[model samples]
Target: MRKLVCVAAMLSLGVTQVTFSADLAGAKDHPLVSRFRGADAVGYGQADFGNARLPSGANGKHTDAAGRLTDIVYRAPPGKRAAEVFENYRQALAGAGFAISWQCGPGTRDDGCGGFRFAGDLADPVIATLKGDSSEMIKLLDATNNNVSYLIATLVKNGQTSTVALMVSQDDERPTGVLLRVIDAAPMAQGQVTVDAAAMAKGLAAEGKITLYGLHFATDSATLTPDSKQTLDEMAKALKAAPALKVYIVGHTDNTGALAHNEKLSQDRAAAVVKALTTTYGIAANRLAAKGLASYSPVAANTSEPGKAKNRRVEMVAQ
Candidate 1:
């Protein structure tokens, strides 16, 4: 059988027993993270490249990353406990050079993980996992909301990081089900992820705000690249087309490093845009207000470069 993910090392941990069955049609393992031995995959879904919002730490914190996301719902053979399945994954992940970022099992907390709000926060993942190959095999799929065993682990290899989260359920009416999801950081193909002036004008007219990704800057610096002139020229044209329009030139950044530093950098980037508009593009200074949201307002997650790329953008909000 062609298995996905590298869990062969799990055998050394006394998980040597093996059983085989057909996984759901068009479903398979993650190819980098494996399932518990003899576990039948009841649900499987994959995104070659996309964003994932995984609940982290207590108190509703979340880790939103963009990359290849693979979610698998596996049910172990009879006579297995959810805790055992969760423990097997922990050891296997550790053996595979992964570090546990956060973990919680039943009876290990005060307000319960219910305070973490995984159910409410991660409704998307739940919905995605449930719909792939029918939800009947997985039952309620309530592990996220229930006080179940769960853990998040990360592995950094060759300068890229891969994260995996496991949630195990111990429902009396169902077999032990493991929700395994893995995401690895990858660069999104650079293309026209940005909009042109025509689209920008339409967006502003429709939504009162338009997010722009055309402005270029170096790492941790606010200076615009030479290629940014084209985007600026387009912006200038847009502003000229709407002579009475007043807008807020807001700067945003990805969630990285110290929050205060990003705040200052974002402000500087916004100011740079304003300077170019007034001094070079002939936009009046009074018509534009520059504000910095830093990482506070992100269009995407900051966990991966692609997500961060989307987050680090400027916006024009009608003023």
Candidate 2:
């Protein structure tokens, strides 16, 4: 027969068995500190360049210039002390051309450095992780002096600035933990409304409401950007073309803070737009009603940057 019997190799008396090692839990490290070892990753995330607030000095905070952010949380190998991990990271950062900005550690008064106050949907998970059965770890958090250690450093490379925060703490039981947040300042989403007044009018005429994208604003503020002039002029033209048309100006925001805060911000922004249309564009104040919808009426999902951008907008609704 064409098929022959296959013989399997017999085990030798002196043969050794080969085994492969498994990766440690959360072992991945960010590229900035890939050389340092001993900790396993427990959490990781990234966002396109955005503002980061870092502890400045005692009882103060500094806002980093906009940049990409890479956040990582790691659990230290057993027997690794918090102080040891902090010092090691400090040295490593310095060696990598980073200048120390601020540091808080044991023996320092509680100044609220290195602690994070998460907002919006991100709060529950972060709070649970920080507060769960780990009294020692909680005490070691930024702003507490229960043996917590944290460092902030700045690095400038290729005409771009980057900031890093390394906070370390110990758990009550086995493994210690470290939170590493890095922000690399880089170009991000451009704030400019490209849609003209005709398009806005057409959309409103057909859909009863039109979302405006070109109304730019400063971060966390209602002040309109100078570049918003084009969009504003177009909106004015549309209002002039339909003198009898009354519309409701609605402002919206992304889900990034407490519901109340976001609602108030949206209201303020809507009022600002109404004021601009009246004073700057000569649109009659009575023809426009301002309202803030906050994040309740979203046109897209809130899980991604594009969705968040879409949600942060102003709409003209025919009344």
Candidate 3:
């Protein structure tokens, strides 16, 4: 009888050890974020504070001010479809005071908007890291790789605007995946410290170089924002006041991503600034040379958000 009982106990242990569910071990939702009902977190990461570029509309992006950035990946409960998962989160976000900025899904009215294409790019790293050796799971993710449904939303709470990007996809394996990214936009930086034409002239005369912090550009793009007009105008005025003052318009960036990419991006931005000064502000094009030094001469350490912000600026050096 004792031998029979021992065999039964061993059988019970084998039954209890059966594995199920694909959620990543020890994954959990962030404090400032939440997962959809019946969904389990499969991956997560966060930066204490950073900037996030949120999709504004079709083919458009906007940079949120410095704040905490959080990313979470979730697996939907069995029997749920990707579209349904997206809708559930959309409704939940709306209920939580988030205004939908944009939304798209497979076969939906906005199906061809390229939102899903962007989502696939955003999900690549997360899935690669968390899916591991599960070839079936990888294939499942790739099946809907181009059919992802997504939503971008914003909410203002506690005097801060928070941006959210949510994406969902599913495959024949019956498991849906959702990726959530949130950026808590901090208050806009204080008014830009402007160097007037007089200050620029003095600096050029004495130090042969002047740094300007007022110029602004869209995140990861050469396009100047509207608020950059005043700064460009000042620069043009200084150049016009001294017709013989040839200078180099140097662009600098923070060491955030790939060095090569940053070098190219900075060069493009400097060239754009030169074009704006000449064409829009009526400064002579021959008087300015555009150069990108990348992150070689950072004014501060790149270990913190404020330092990174300071490193991304345009400067003028006498030539």
lDDT leader: 1
- Total clashes for model 2: 5
lDDT of 1 by residue, 1-319 (tens): 2222356453232343333456776666664577777788777777778777776787766787768777777877788777777777887788778889888776222234636543334433465554455454435245533546778888877677888888777566567777788897775644255577788799899999988777877778989877677778888888999999999999998888899999999999998999999999899999898999999977766656887878888888999
Clashing residue pairs in candidate 3 are none
lDDT, candidate 3, 181-228, per-residue tens: 877765337235778889999998999899888888888998988888
Q: After superposing candidate 2, which stretches have Cα over 4 Å from the reference?
A: 1-27, 107-145, 191-199, 202-319
lDDT of each: 0.73, 0.65, 0.69
What does the lDDT read for residue 103 in candidate 1?
85
Runs of candidate 1 exceeding 4 Å displacement: 1-21, 48-66, 106-125, 128-131, 140-147, 186-194, 202-210, 217-311, 314-319
In terms of TM-score, which candidate is strongest? 1
Q: Model 3 reaches what TM-score against the true structure?
A: 0.48
Among all windows of ten consecutive residues in candidate 3, which has the lowest summed lDDT?
A: 1-10
Ranking by TM-score: 1, 2, 3
Q: Please give the RMSD to the true structure for each candidate, in Å.
A: 7.1, 16.2, 16.6
lDDT for residue 195 in candidate 1, whole number 0-100: 73
